[model samples]
Target: MCKDKIAVVLVTFNRLDKLKQAVEYYEQQTYPIQEVVIVDNHSTDGTIQYLKEWVNGKGNFKRKTVLLNENCGGAGGFGAGMDEVLDEVRRHELDADWVAVADDDAFPRKNSFEKIIDYYKSLSDKEQEDISVLCSRVVNCGKTHINHRNRIKQSILRARFMAVPEEEYDKDAFDIDIFSYVGTFIKVNALQKVGTTNRDLFIYGDDQEHSLRLRKVGRMQCVPSSVYDHDRPGLGERKIGWHSYYDSRNHVYILKKYFPIQCLIMRCIKRYILDMSVFSSNTQQERKLFKTAYMDGIKGNLGKNSVYKPGFEITDRKD
Candidate 1:
């Protein structure tokens, strides 16, 4: 064993059972996880109490938590969790080299941590110098690769980001432009340099945005052998709801941040006129929400929307 210390961090709202399962899963990993940081977004359920009790015993991993007063969404929860790890490291409380930012419902397989570390250790010292983020191949329960890894596509006049195809998951090791928070393992030093996920983003696009920042620091390798199972369903289709707002708002921020020229002209003209309104958003209400989203993004007003919100509270049974 390389004996490098790692910490796993995840965000949870009120799904106590799922949270417990996630922690147990991480504990079951072949490679030891030194600590688990649970960021609770003000769960009304007995999550805080559960964690207090969960940490009391003969567990393989030490448990830590960040209990928020209000729901800051996944982006804020994750950012806080990673920042907590970084702070712990700075304080010499957490002797960790890497931190895995994951969702409450997603985690790497039992051997995943071991495989990922082994692959990293296999690389020559020179090869390892350029690699800072080691991402896992995230897959849904269907045993198909989720749209986890992606290569960015953008230019002065246009921008597009699509995940690499399922076949690409077969590659043992390959570089990618982006990785998801579902199971992305990041080097603590690299995260410190790039900073944590944008808290303003609140939810959607936070992972992608943070991944872009991490990419600038060093190479990100996608190792399918380090398989991650995301216990979720396939995204069916767009439903007109609170999520529509965040999806609309953060997208413009990403476009404007990365492709400024394109965002200036294209997002204002093309996306605003076509993709956002006339077609994508069907109802007048949907259009209104999207319009607010676009305006917020344009004015650099990013954060949890006062009107638009996340619909995750009534969560549990695979819906």
Candidate 2:
């Protein structure tokens, strides 16, 4: 271990069991997490009480929890958690060299963090300084690579990014243009240089936006040795439902953030045409929501959970 303070920001909403599992995995990390900053998006599933118990339980780890007044989604949760770390650094209460963001359903192996830090330790000072984000290989439940690394399509007319195929993953550390937040360990200084995660995004595509913005700061690497299991279905395995709105809306905002309006419109058209079958499967209300997302997205209206909001009360499964 390099003795650099690392803060793991775990964001959760109504997933108490998965949250507990995530905390346990972090606790078991060989490199030892210096601090764990958990942002509860008003889980309302008895997660608060469980977190209280976990905090009070016997452990050598330093942990902090933030219960937001509202459900800010993953983007806002991470933004808030990182803001907490930055505030501590400002107040001279803590010195965080890196901040790792993880979801409630992601569980990193015990040596994953150690391997990530070891890679940094092996780097020369100049190399280390130029490195921005260190990402992990995300494998699905079936132990298959999830193609987490994203690269922007090299076209003037296209405003989208493409994921490298699983067969192409070489199982070695390599540079990438964008990465997801599931097991992303970002340098604190790099985050400071490129601003913070966009809280306005609320959820889907926020990681891509943040990672793309980080390209100006330093290089991003995906370390295959640092593996984590993301308990999520394969891409396109499930029909777009609750997240369709966010995904639909954020897709435009993200494209517009990176490309010109004309290119963005072109990409949107291509995507809309290709996804017509998926859209047709959606119910009337879902189609309406999708249309609203499309209209709001094209207009560059990136608001919070005002249009469609999830439950924030203390309900186990009433949502």
Worst 10 residues of 2 by lDDT: 310-319
Candidate 1 Cα misplacement greater than 4 A, ranges: 1-3, 275-281, 312-319
Give a tens-digit lDDT track for model 1, residues 182-220. 778898888879899899888888988998888898899
What is the TM-score (0 to 1) of candidate 2? 0.87
Residue-level error in angstroms, candidate 2, position 97: 0.6
In model 1, how large is the Cα lDDT of residue 214? 88
lDDT of 2 at 81: 91
- True-vs-predicted CA distance for residue 116, candidate 1, Å: 0.6
Worst 10 residues of 1 by lDDT: 310-319
C-alpha lDDT of all candidate models, in order: 0.80, 0.79
Candidate 2, residues 189-299, lDDT tens digits: the string is 888778788988888888988988898889998887888999877465444555777888898877777777788778667656544335454445555666777778878
